[model samples]
Target chain A: MLEVLAERFNYAVIIVLMMVGLYAVIATGNLVKRLVGLSIFQTSVFLLYISVSKVFGGAPPIFDYKDLAYDKLDPNAIYSNPLPHVLILTAIVVGVATLSVGLALVVRIREAYGSIEDDTLAEADYSLELEKGV
Target chain B: MSASDITQYFDYIFMAMLLCIGIAVIRLRNLFAVVMLTGAYSLISAAWFVSLDAVDVGFTEAAVGAGISTVLLLGAMLLTSREADKTSLGRHAAAAVVTIAAGAGLFYALGDMPVYGDAASPANTGVGMEYVDLTAEQIVIPNVVTAVLASYRGFDTMGEVFVVFAAGLGVALLIGLGGSKREED
Candidate 1:
């Protein structure tokens, strides 16, 4: 069963991590916790991509001729796709940029409301909207 | 079951997981949780893409779906409320039902999709073959995924970056700039 699970483990883990992140986002009222959930959720995708790139018996794409012990490339060798790894590298950078900007905004929201609870913030916004008569 | 049989049944498992995660994402009441579930849904879909051997597409989807989208969603949620009016649940339920129905219909409609790596697929038969055949010699990138995404799909990537920039700008505008404080009247 473990081996079977391992065969599709990448998909399984991705789904589980997603649910965990989802639960955090749904259950937690704290803004920072929500952000953390969001980060976890995103990181799971990174794992998914990395997992997908693995071929059944593939070796890394690196090619080095200095080692005389190393044989030449075998035409039938199954090399795990390296494209996904490169893509995820770009994505991780983008995710970091987005997270930093988001955290900065959360700080501003906290400053404005003096609290991060959704209800309190909503009430404050409603009152402001009411006063403005928009 | 033999190894091939196991691989065959993996498809059903992936589909079931996708459905379950999708439902959870919609059914969950917490806005933050919903966003997180949405990320899960994306990861599941990315796995499906990998199963199809669209490794490059899967990578792009996994990153955008799970990473950038989640952060942007949480940013939007932060400026808003997680606890919505209880009265809105009925409408939300209706929306959920409609969404599921439409999604199911779409899935059913695609029953004729070519099998993964089928010889007739455009990626297998046409100029794509030239791409696959010539990648090592022409690009010297070693990784076909990189060659396709960075070189062949460069224009699309530039557009994707622009979209991300636009989304960040929109969020900034919605939340305001430099943390200006409003005076209490």
Candidate 2:
């Protein structure tokens, strides 16, 4: 157990960050702050993937074509795993786009309700519903 | 301690900074400062990613996470309240419970994960190496990550581009361009 803890301590720390993000998303009434929490959570996952790709004494995934011929590729050459990097590239773009749209929606919500706090927005919504009922 | 040991300590320092920043983001009531701290947090994360030899991922994180996202958050902050309301103590207690429980559960699950940076770890030994090995012959790109993203995962990348486009459209529809003649009229 001690050995496992020592080896994977990084992951435990990252998971703690993930939880902090999760808490912010759920607990914060400010919509933009919630999005910040969402960003933190997404980033923690990205770090986990990057951590998984690390290779001891490995160079970056970029190949230096000037140094070595493609045909005579060195079998023993070490490079950090590139697959996770590729996967996360697309994800990062999507994250930014999603955040932009979320912000725009927050702008619209503020325009509608005169407040961006989730609780205040919900109160406005419930009052609208009550007015219709009465 | 050797150079590698020193680097490991740097990692520890970065991780500690990340933890402190995360707590600060949650505890602070000032929305603008929280957004700025989030940007700083992501920049540190990019530094960590670069240290892990994920230069491409780090680059993307710096551009998207710290750059574009911060600008968007700031623009939104311009339209929203600057400070968040304080929640009840009961809500704080509930949030703390939920966060600690989730963290403990994930920590327990970490015991089964492959040790960090092990060359033979499943993530490295699987299709990961095949991409590295074949990128030279098949794609001829200096960056294997770029080759795989453009050639091997063309469909997924295209979908992501379309998603970005759609998101832009959605934002434009929701919040019209302020300087546009259509909005001015």
Candidate 3:
């Protein structure tokens, strides 16, 4: 048990962060707070991907351009795998876009219904439905 | 202490800080403080990413997570109340149950993942190694991440860029430049 825990401590931490974010998204009533939760949750997954891409003794995945040698592997270098980083770069941008849209929606929601709380918003909509007999 | 041990210690410290801040965000009713803490959480996690040999991802995380999202969230908050509506105990309980179950499921499955930072891990061995080894030879770029994102996966990046553009257009259509005109009249 101890060995398993030690080997994957980072995973455990990531999982805890994920759960916190999930709880925030699920439990929070405020729209903005829920979005914050969603951001936290998205970044946790980002960290998880970064963690997977790490190389134990790896350097950052950039070359020192001054040394303009040609073909062979540099014995001193252990570059971190760049695939996950590439995927995450795209993901980070998309996450920002998603947050922007979500916040815009929240702004419009506040304008449309005087309140951003889910329960209050639902109540207002429900009362509107009742009044309309639909 | 050895260098790796020290690095691991820092990792643990940052993870602990993240965990604490996450709890604080959940516990606090003031939405403003929670928003700020969320940014701090992003900043710290970005640092963690740097330590994991993912400097490129770390840079993007710092930029997107800490900077842009914080500013946007704060902008949105200006249009809403600062205090959050507290959730009922039963609702929170249900959320906790779901979160725990999800956490436990991930935890159990984690052992199957390649150990952290093993270069010989499955992800690093086949196509990934091919990309790394061939990227410089064929592309002549100093940064493998840039080459892969811009050249190899150019289509995906283009799609993402368009997604961002579309999202901006959507936000503009939803809120307008001056924000719903306030309608004070």
Q: Is candidate 1 or candidate 2 better by TM-score?
A: 2
Docking class of 1: incorrect
Off by over 4 Å in 2: A69-72, B1-6, B179-185
Q: Residue-wise lDDT of candidate 2 within B1-185, one digit each (tens)?
A: 11132345657988999999999999999998999999999999999988888888888889888998998898899888899989778877888898888888888788789887678888789998899988887887788998889899899899999999999888889887665867667
Off by over 4 Å in 3: A69-76, B1-6, B179-185
Pick the winner on DockQ between candidates 1 and 3.
3
Candidate 2 chain B least-lDDT 10 residues: B1-10
Candidate 1 structure quality by residue, lDDT tens digits, B138-158: 665555666766787678667
Evaluated with TM-score, which candidate comes out highest? Answer: 2
- lDDT, candidate 2, A18-129, per-residue tens: 9989998878888999999999999999888888888777889887776445365677889989999998878988989999999999999989889988888888889999
TM-score of 2: 0.94
Model 1 alpha-carbon miss at residue B14, Å = 3.3
Task: TM-score chain B for all models.
Answer: 0.68, 0.91, 0.90
In order, candidate lDDTs are: 0.57, 0.86, 0.86
Give the winner by DockQ.
Answer: 2
Lowest lDDT block of 10, candidate 1 chain B: B114-123
Alpha-carbon deviation at B40 in model 2, angstroms: 0.4
Tens-digit lDDT string for candidate 3 (B34-88): 9899899989998998888788888888998899999999988988889998799
Docking class of 3: medium
